[model samples]
Structure formats: structure tokens, C-alpha cells
Target: MRKIWLTGIAALAMASCTSKTSTPQPTASALAALPTTDWKSFRDTFIEDWFKVSPADAVYQGRHDFDGGLGDWSPAGLKRQGDFLRNAIAKAKTFDAAKLGKQDAFERDYLVTVAAGKLFWLEDADFPHRNPAWYVNAGLDPNVYIARKYADAPTRMRAMVSFLRKIPTAAAQIRANLKTPMPLSYVNFGVAAFNGFGDYYTGDAKKAFADVKSPALQEEFDKAAVAASKAMHDLGAWLEGQRGSATQDFALGADKFSRMIKETERVDVPLATLEAAGQADMKRNQLALVAACAQFAPGASVPACMAKMNANKPANNDPVAEARKQIPELRAFVLKSDVVTIPDQEQALVEESPPYNRQNSAYIDPPGPFEKGIPSVYYISPPDPSWSKVEQAGFIPGKSDLLFTSVHEVMPGHFLQFRHANASPSLFGRLFVGYAFAEGWAHYAEEMMWEAGLHAGDPETHIGQLSNALLRDCRYLSAIGLHAHGMTQEQSRKMFVEQCYQDEGNAKQQSARGTYDPAYLNYTMGKLMIRKLRTDWTATHGGRAGWKAFHDQFLSFGGPPIPLVRKAMLGGDGKAVF
Candidate 1:
């Protein structure tokens, strides 16, 4: 959850520059006097600062500039970064956007938006010091796997050693910043992950470090390994101190939550409105699920139908291998359907999720620049080998349910849309849009795929997709309820299990996740907004447009809010800017 930073003054100024310019006017004195070169310089500097603040983010994005440097989450460091962002914002405001070219204007708009968002977080939210997951999850371990694919083995090992060495300092900052009513659930999860990670290193360290002939490197790796063990120990001890005292109430209160909706998502709807919309969607999806279930198992109840569907799922010697086998077919379906345009260079690889990165079942690894041909990974969590079949079944995607998660996480979803985004010409488009739109587009894409007849041959498949939709709709409602309506975790879990028909264990995990990720609401909210935008766009264009054209145009602007999409497509300014 890295914050986007920039100011409104800069946006307004840049917008003014982009207003209906008649001619190129290359020789104009105003353009000549503008700080165009300075703006590009500033943009690079800002990106560098951004990489410095979140080095793990850089590695994830395939930037090896800060390979060995871990991010500092200390309060002093956060304040320093905040101060830097504020100063950058102030400097950005001084630029005379009225005299700049189109590219410069776009850059200014993006910088301002990013800077303002950062300043808002620094001043209004306790997020910097209060969230322990931010630090715990932002580690070098996950990136090591990705980076190792590209870097030499020894260089990769050295980077790992350097990263492990910083754990003590990183863990100390986390301990120092522990707020009242600590995020104990997240702490417990983090401790579990750290403990698992320590075991991974301890068992594999010698092999990973075997080729390093230098004694200095060997000693450094040993020292770092010891430090990491200590850090994990300290973290567990600190987590134990706040066990029963963790806050059960997950509300962000109305004002702050609303601000999040507006600033991060650029959604104009109130939280209550979003909640109402989610409930309606929940009901609609529930009905659809019931209808699909009845079609699959005539006259059976929803649960009975689900049991039948689950019963018929493919048995496997390796559940993870079976899941992996399904991915290529899904990707092929999305590509052949032409629902969304995917990059020619984008590599969609499936990898097992590391223990440290397994809070969720799957996530899309970020891509690098299109020119360099960076690959996107669809990370699937392998079932624990020691778990019973019953325990393992909870994670293994049922055959009928496989495409739903596939569409959401991979093709015609995050991976597909992000490839387009990374290749976007607008640097601001490349950097500054919100995750709500990004995640929302993916969620929307999943539903849209079904609507386009993805699983028309199988009623059970449709039921599974609808059930997943119900789950997300419930997430939207639960997120709003927990953060805007003061719903307790128990209450949230109950709502999910009862209405969403999620298993008890899954319900509990989702509820706990919502405490830290309130913006989970965006999946449904964004999808609904995208649907509305599509309908409006279709109606205005005589409903004659092809889905490919519509979807391509929609995604081409990167992941701006649906409202911004409407403005870009229908405002008739003819600029076609994102």
C-alpha cells in the first residue's frame, strides 16, 4: 500500500496548459521560456526518490537500481519522506504549466496528483506508524526470487545477504512504531510468515551461498542470517505482548473512509451509496448463483449444488500442478476472445507463492518497461504438503471455479491490463493512477468475460463464477460495513459466511484481511462503475461498437476512475488523453 503523491494546484495548472491548443507553434517565445527540460529532470528525480523510499517496489517493477537496499519504515524516515514530498509538491506548483507542451502538461498533472495524495496521507492518516503489515510485507525475500532470474547467481546471493542484514533495523522500527490497539492479527500473520521465511533461509542458505568463495561474503551471509533470526524472535515477542488487545473494530470512520474513496479511487459516490449498491449486487449475484446452481443440479439447494460441483472436481497427485495446468487454457481463452489487448512482449508465468507472500492466494507481479520485456508472474500458493485433503481442498481451486480466479488475476484482468498500462505513453498514466481502478478493472473483466460466454457449455462453471461474484459483492458490503459502519470482525465474518456462502475459514480470513485492506470494496465498486461507464459509452455510440474496440479503448487510458474515463471518452474535447 504505497501512497501516491502530488498536488491539485499542479493538476489545475497542467490542465490549463492542455486546453484546446490550435497549433504546434514551435517557435513561440512562451514555449521557449518554459521549464520543460527541468520538468523531465524533476520527474526522474521524483521517480528516484520513490524507488529510494520503497526499494522492494522498485525490484518488483524490475528496476535493479536499489537491489540490496531495504525500505526504512521508521517514523523519522516517514516524516523525512513526507517533508520531501511536500517540498516537491511546492516546487511543482511553481512551474508555469500554461506555457508547457502537451507532454510536460501531462507530467505536471501526474506529479501534482501524486504529491497531493502523499501530503494528505502524511497529515491526516496514522497509516505510516500504525500499520505493521506495511513493513513486514515489504521485504527483500519475495523480490529475491524474481531478481535471481535476471541477475548472476552470486550477485543475487550478495543482494540477499545485504537485504537480510537490514532486518534488525527494519524490525526495530516496526517495534518502535507499534500503535495502541495494535494490528495484532496482522502481526500474528507476519510473525508466522517471518518464522517460515527464517526456516527457508536456514535450510537453504548454504546452498544459496555455496558458490560464494569469499570468506567476507560467507561471514556477511552468516551475520545477516543470525540478525534475521533475532528480528523474527523480537517480532514474535512484541506480537505476543498485544495478542488479546488487538482492535476488533475495523472502522475508518465516515470522513476518512470517504476521503479514501475520493482520493485513492476518485469515486464520487458516498460510502452509504456504495454499500447500498454492493447489497443490490450481492442480491443479484446471489440470485444468479441460485439460478446457475439449479441448472447444474436440478432442484437442489445452493449448498448441495456446491457440494456436487466440488465433488466432481478433478483429483490430482499434486493439487498445485493441476491448478497450474488450468492457467494456460484460461490465458489462451482470454487472448483468443479478444476481450482485451495484451502486450506482445508480456510473459505470463505462473510461480508458487512464497510463504512470506501468501497472505492472499494469488497476486500479479508488476512488470518492467515494455522495451526490456519484463515478465508478469501469476503467483499461486501451493497447498501445504502436511495438510489433510480436507484442509488442502479449501485452497485448491475447484475445476468449475478455476477460470474465475484466472480471469481476475491473469488474462483479461490485472496482468493483461497492467501490460497495457506499463506501455502507456503518458508517464503520468504509467505511474499515477489508483489501484481501485486497476483492481476494479480486473474484477470487472472477470464478470465481463462470463457475460461474453466464457463458460457457456458448463452450468456449474457459471455457478462457480457467480458464487465468486457473490463473494466479491459481499467483500464490498463488508468493507463498507467494517470501515464506515463500525462492524466487528465477527459480524463481518458472519455476513460473509451467511450471505456470500463462503466457508467459515475463508470468511474469517477475508474478515481479518478487511481490517488492513479497507479498499477491498473497490473490486465491486469499480466493476459496477465500469459497467455503468460501458453502458453509457455504448448508448452514446449507438450500441454498435465491438467489445474488443470498447475494451481496448477503455484500458488504453490506463486505470483512471470510470468518471475520468467518461470525461476522456465523452467530453468531446477530442484530446483522447488518459
Candidate 2:
């Protein structure tokens, strides 16, 4: 139930000099310098202020100088951060995009969206004070210092100790800031995760950093960790008490939800349009699934067919190892098929996800765009041993499912797309990676690889790809349904089982996820956006044969909202996104 937030200006302090041509320029665009240089002054003051409010994120992003400090959740501190965002947004308006180059204009647009997104969260939604989940997700991880190896063991251990020391203050702020009569789902999530994290901090997390040999540092860590664990335990105890009294009133509502979509993603489409699109995708994938099921086994029930497919899962049911086995081959497929360029020389290392980071079964942990020469992590969390046998079975995906996930996480998906991003001359390209663009390209890459004959269009391969597609489709429907249409968790869970063919365990997990992460809908929504953009851009540029050309062009801009990317790619933004 973590909120998706990245609160910083695009790239203000890094670039000090704007590039200008000496020769006679074609127009104002040719004469115009990269606005990044001019905007550099804003980033310096902004980032310093930002780090003060969100030090853990700064350290997580490899800004080790901001090490050891926890975020300020007190009223005065919150107001200071809010005012900082307002001023940054106001300053961003002064950049005259009319005289700037195409790249500069795009950068300007992106920076505005980033500012607007931050403002929307702080002022509009006011999530910090309202949502209790923020308190948990924000301070829930004292183990990040152990998780990331940006520095040596001793240094990281010290940072961990400092973070641990700050936990009591952070927990006190959480107690003070949270409003009562909390949403049942949010309270339940906080109770489970916060309590579970307290256990992790006391045991597994301590084990992770136990290798640091300095006895003095160890003594400091022991004391700090004890205090941090108690803080979490106390926070969890309070939340557990509230859970019984919590009610189901978690929707972002229509206006704020609509504004959320617009300000964060630049998708101005109506809710009905989004729901209709999702329903259509669900039906489309269902038909494809039916056909694939038919091809796999003639006239079998969907469940029976799925059971047969599920039984074809990994030998030991270890997706992490299976992912490691398949990724090199997936890369070979990319080169053979020539779908998109693979600029990533480094491969994503597969491993178990950290204890604090195991909300989903699997995820790719990419380095921040400013980070280079660092290996990307593709973390696969196995089913908790506490789960029942049937539940554990549901956690294990079929081999083909793992293959598509590998394609999405590595090779020509996130990892490869990011390599092109890092190569971008625009700092905006590197820094301002949007959720829509990143998830869209990764999602699009799944089907694109299949279209390029990943398994020669085999039926099982189709089943795997379509199953993932349907899951995303269900997410799209459930997001709209739960938030905009008043759909209950039970109803959303039923939709997953009925339409997406998800297992009981997965259905519950996904349904509960939509309660907190409405933006999970972006998987299908973003994939479709990329598909439409590709079809339109490729038609005029070259036809289907220009797949690689379209992909290279699309990924070259790094991650901006699809609308801005569309405006850049198509020469103008239109009313109809699709």
C-alpha cells in the first residue's frame, strides 16, 4: 500500500552551462539553449531543501551525503516542503518555451508535470496527513542501508544506525499526523506490514548487516535497532487497535482522481473512456486466452486448462532461477529478432527481494538514472513459508510466464530501455523517468517480443503472454471500478478470477492492491498507449517493418508522460489519445 512519490525538481543544479550554436541558427529553437542550464539554479536550492524533508530517499538514490536523516513529518516541516514545491512550480513558469528548442520545450513540459505531480500530492490530495499508509511506507524500512550497497559496510552500517535512531521520532510523527476513523484496508495493511517489519528489523535485517565487524558500531546499531523495533511495534499496536474500528472509505473520489490522472500522467481521458478501454482489453484477452486454451487442449474448461498449464511450471518451482536461466536467451532473441537495441552491457542480477520490499511476488529494482555502472536487481520473492500449499502453488508462475516477465524486466524491456535513457543528452531523459513511460515500454515490450516470434507464436507462449495481459486488464478495470465506480474488494476479486483467470490467492492480492495502488491500472493502459503511438508513428515513418526504428525512437527520450512523448513524436498532441 505504498504511495508512488518522487518529490524533486527535474534537473536544476547539475547542468551549469547551456549549449549555444556559433553558426547562424535556423530559428529561435536553433538559437535557444537547453533550459536545464538556466534552470540549474532552481535545482540546487530545491534539492537541498528536498533532502532535508526526504533524506532516506536521497540516500536510496545514491546521494550518500544525505545519509542517516529521516523525513520530517512535523507540521512546520511539512509546511516548509509544501511552500518549497509552490515556489518551484512558480519559478518553473518563468521559462519561455516558445524560444526554446524541441528538446528544451519537452524538458520544460516534463519539469512542470513533475512539479505539478508533487503539488497535487502535497496540497491537493494532502496524502501525508490523511493516509496512515504513508506513515508506514515512509518509515517502514530501516533496512534500506543493508539492502543497497552504494557505500562500504561500515559507512552503510552507520547510516543504518542513524536511521534506526530516528525511528522513534518518525513513529511519534506518524502517531500525531494520522487522522482517525481510518480506511479499513489502509489500517489493516499498516497493522500487518508495520508489525511484520518490526519482526524483520529485529531479526532478518540485523542478520543482513551482521557482517560489519566494528564492535563499537555494532553496539550502536544494537541500541538503535532496539529502539527502532519498539517504535514500529508501538506504531503497529496502535494501528491494530484501530483496524477493528476502520471503515471502507478509501476512494480518492472523482475530481481528485481525475486530477490525479491528468496532473501525474497527462492522460486527460474521461473515466468512462478508461473503463471502456479496459473492458474491451479484458474481452479481447479473454478471447485470445480461450483460443490459446483451445489450441493447448481441445474443449477443456478454463480452470482445467490452466491447471494443466500450471502443472507445467518450473521443475522446482523457483522463478528466480528460471529467470536467470532465460534472460541471456531472451537477449539472444532480441538480437536475432532485432526488436529494439540492447544498449545495456550489464545483465540484471536475480535474487530474493528484501524482507521490507516484498509486497509483490516479483519486481525489478533499477538504479536511479543518475546511477551508472551499477547492476540492476530483478528481485523475485518466493511465497512466504507461512502460506498454505495451495497458496504457494498459486505463487509459482509457469515457465512461459517467467519468460515474459524476464522480457519485461530485462533484455529489451526496463533494463534495456534504461540504457538508452542513460545515453540521452537531455538530463530530463536521465532524471525524470515517468511511471507511464517506464511501465508502458516494459509492458509493450512483452507483446512486441511475442510478435517478433519469441516462441514462434506457440500456444503456451500465447497463454503466458495473454494471462499477464489479462492480469493487467483486470487491474485497469478494478482501478476504475474501485475508485470511480464504487466497486467492492469482493467484486474486484471476482472480476480477476472470472475475467483474468487468476488464482484465488492472486485474485485477493491484486484486488487488495487496487484499494491502495489505483495506478496499477497503468500496466494495460500504458501498454495500449504505446501500441497506439507505435502504430501511428510507424505508419507515416515506415510500416510494421520499422518496429526497431519506432522502438529506438520511443525509448531514446527516456521516460516522460506519454502525452508529452506523443507531442514530441507526432508533432502535436491531439484530443484522442488512442
Candidate 3:
């Protein structure tokens, strides 16, 4: 909800560039239409409809046909889209499973899940009306055109211009549709986002197309982009005006929150059980931190040891440079340890995140699934220099903490895990990877790598990894607390500081993120599910040796919810998910 970016997708292309392999070729079976197969026809139309509603999704997915198209965000349009999903679900269920292949059936499950998530947000949760983010942020991927190279500069510029020209219309619909007295958090996020739209539309869009030699296209882009920015500025100012009336009633309530977990992720674990798991993980991390503190500093207080860790910040607080320097060493560590295969020599490019996209301090925008070979941009939003010294300092992470982030964002984390997903043989596996699996695996990688001798069991490194774990655990608690149990923002902020040991600045930011991103509990929730899967799965697959195999196999299913993937991976066993 606060649009916090949790996972960094390392463009595995850079990671995979050394292989000298060309773009993924559509197989004969994949390209040619088998009109007779219920699955193929259904899959084709399903993908078409997805692009039909969210053309930005097409741009991200590398489908250029819909690149310039925009969604109709009016109320009736949303219902039309919802109806399509409902009908699609019923149609998918009507197919006789006995006639479908193993993968086809699994794809059906993925299809249902995808449709359900869309319907839930539109119909159940009422995201379109209640949330400013739903409308103001539509088709607003800052790097969609900048990051991907699906086509030459001129052609892509034309597409971007086409899309930018539609922004005014989108803004008009949003102005008409969005309810006033929007959630305070949503309004604040919208104001910041739209204010940043000026820089993104005017400057970044131009830079992205700077190499374009087409004069006429450039002129069109200039005209379109200018108008788009004006629309955004007006919309943003309008939201600011409404901020006075914006209430803090943002929670999805108990019922919708539960359904969000159950339907979207296919997890039905009760809130109490989830809270217990989060608390257990937080305590475990705290105890580990205590032990690590003792080893790192035998007689120092917790605050003192943390000060030492914080002191390890980069020279002049240049995190971008530090992250760049660590890339090679992290890659080498993974290779030497057999933690997982690197598969290529391409590197993740680290940089300061764009202003509009800095809703979270750090995130990765990897090339979409259809992308062949492009750099995945991992972004860390260092604090604004204008902020107070204390605020700026909170944004600069310690050296060991930075390393764990590198692991989470790149090296054997989101980037590496996605490498396995990118190689999936099925379209469903390639496109439908679930958020829980993606973020969960990245979060889990931090501890898993440490256990595998990363940093040779250094206490500082353990503190960094455990600290991240504790942060995610607090996210789990804060999400359920905020949405289900009526936890106040002040209470959640205190929870972050007291339970997770977050600094005041970070505690404040993370607490607000929970107001909108209730599903963030997925970090710990998904990890626990994966851990359970590993314990049961590895016992029979052969204990230690089974890990690499598990990591590789787990990623191979694309990004499906673990439950769906689990059902297939474990011979239809679903008990482990519950």
C-alpha cells in the first residue's frame, strides 16, 4: 500500500550474459495455435485480456502490441474488468482436468489465482475507489521504457509518447472516480508520487530517449510528456488539498485481510498462528543478535554494538559506490561456496533510485520475463540531503548490513532465484511467480547463505542478517496488527523500535508501509512455509546435498504461490502449506 519495494530483481541477463545464449525462442508448441486444446486457447485469450486491462503490464511483460494502451479506470470499467475475471475463472474450471496435462492443470491453478487477486482488489477490497494509489499510479512505471530494450530507441520513444499522451485522460478519470477523504497514508503517498512525476516525465523520459534520432517522434514526445506532467502536477496538488480531510482509516479489516492471504497466496493460516510465527522468528533473531553482539563485543551494550555496526558505513556515506565494490566479492563467494550457480558473468547495476519510485529506500526493477538480455537496475534511495542529519544517517546502512542487502537484492537472492524462474519451460511458470515466493526466498536467502559459511560465520555478518530477519518479523506483526487488530500507527512504530530494533526514522517509515502493504507479512509467512517445505522435502531428497537441488527446483516453477508449486513439487501434497 505504501508502495514499498521489498525485492530487488537482478537482471539475470547481466548475470547470464556470459552464456552467449540468444533470446528465448518461442517453441513450436508454444507459438503455433492448437485450436483443439482447451488449455492453449484459454491461455492465449487470458494473456490477451490481461494486456487489455493493464497495458502497462504488457510493456513490463515485453508485449509491445499493447505498449501504448492505457486502462479504463472508471468505476464501470473496473466492474467490466472484474466481470471478465469472474467469467474467466468459471470458464477455466469448466475444462475437464482429466484431459489436461500435468503442467496445464498447474497453469489452471495459476490462472485462477491471478484472476482471484484481481477480482479481490476490485470487488472485495474496493481498491479502485478507496485508494488513490490505485488510480494516480496507473501506468506509472518510472523505468519501463528506460530499463528495457525490447526495441530500438526511436520505436520505443514512439510507444512511450503514445502512452504519455493518454495520461491526461487517465487523470480525468481518476479525478472523477476517486473518493474524497481518502486514507491519509494513501493521500500522502499520492502527493509525493505525483510531485515526483515532474522529474520523471520531464527529465527521465527525455534521457531515456536521448539517443533517438527521429526528430518528429521527439517533438511528439516533448508535447505529450509536457502535458502529462501538468496533469500529474494538478492531480498531486488536488490530493494535497484533500489531505486535510484524509483520514487514517486505511486498514482492510479482518475479513478482507484473511481472504487476501487465503485467496491471493493460497494460505489459510490463522492470524494468531501467523503472529506467533513472527514473534518466534523475532525472538530467535534477537537471541541470535545477543549472541552475535557478545562475540563481536564481549562487554558492550546492545546499543553500543549497534553503534559499532553503524560506524562501518561507507566513506562519506557513499552506499552506491560501496554496493558496486561488493558485487565481485559477493559473486566470488557464491561461486566458491557452491551456494548456488552464478550461471553468467553479467553484473547487477546499483544506483540511486528515482525520486518517484523511492517509496521504499531500496528495490530492484529487473527486466521483464519477455526480456532477453538487459541490465536489471537495483536501486537504493539514499536519504534526501535536505533532511536532518539524523534522517540522512538512518538511510546509510552499515557495511555488513549492506552485504546482506546485496545478497537479498542480487547474488543468490532475488536475482539468482529469478534466474531459476526465467529458465522455466512453461509460460505459466515464467509469468505467474507469486510475491510470497519471490520476496520470501530473498528474505530466506540472507540466513541460508550465512548458514552455508558466508563471511565464515562472522558475528557482524550474523548481526546484519539477523537484523534483517527481525525487521521482516516486525513487518509480519505490524501488518496483522494494523489491519486485523486495530493497531495504531504510533503503536506499530514503537513495535518496530522495541521488537525489531529499527531506528526511529526506519521505524516510522516501515510502520506506515504496513498501513497499505498488509500482505508484507508474506516475507516471514512465506519463509516459514518454505522452511517447512525444505524440512519435509529435504528429509527424503537427501539431507545436505538436497539444498542446492531444492533451491534450483523451487525457482524453476517461475513465481507461483508456494502452495500451488508445493502441490506439484510434493506429488499433490497440500498439507505442508497449511
Runs in model 2 lying further than 4 Å from the true structure: 1-37, 43-48, 135-144, 384-387, 574-576
Candidate 2 local distance difference test against the native: 0.73
RMSD of each: 8.1, 6.8, 5.2
TM of each candidate vs. truth: 0.85, 0.91, 0.91
| Ten-residue region with minimum lDDT total, candidate 3 | 13-22
Of 1 and 3, the candidate ahead on lDDT is 3
- Candidate 2: residue 384 Cα off by (Å): 4.3
lDDT of each: 0.64, 0.73, 0.74
**Ranking according to lDDT, highest score first:** 3, 2, 1
Query: Judged by TM-score, which candidate is best?
Result: 3
lDDT string for model 2 (103-129, tens) is 766776777787687677766877776
Q: Model 3 misses residue 509 by how many Å? A: 1.4
Q: Where is model 1 more than 4 Å wrong at Cα?
A: 1-39, 90-107, 118-123, 137-142, 145-148, 200-216, 317-319, 370-374, 382-392, 542-544, 572-578
Residue-level error in angstroms, candidate 1, position 383 = 5.5
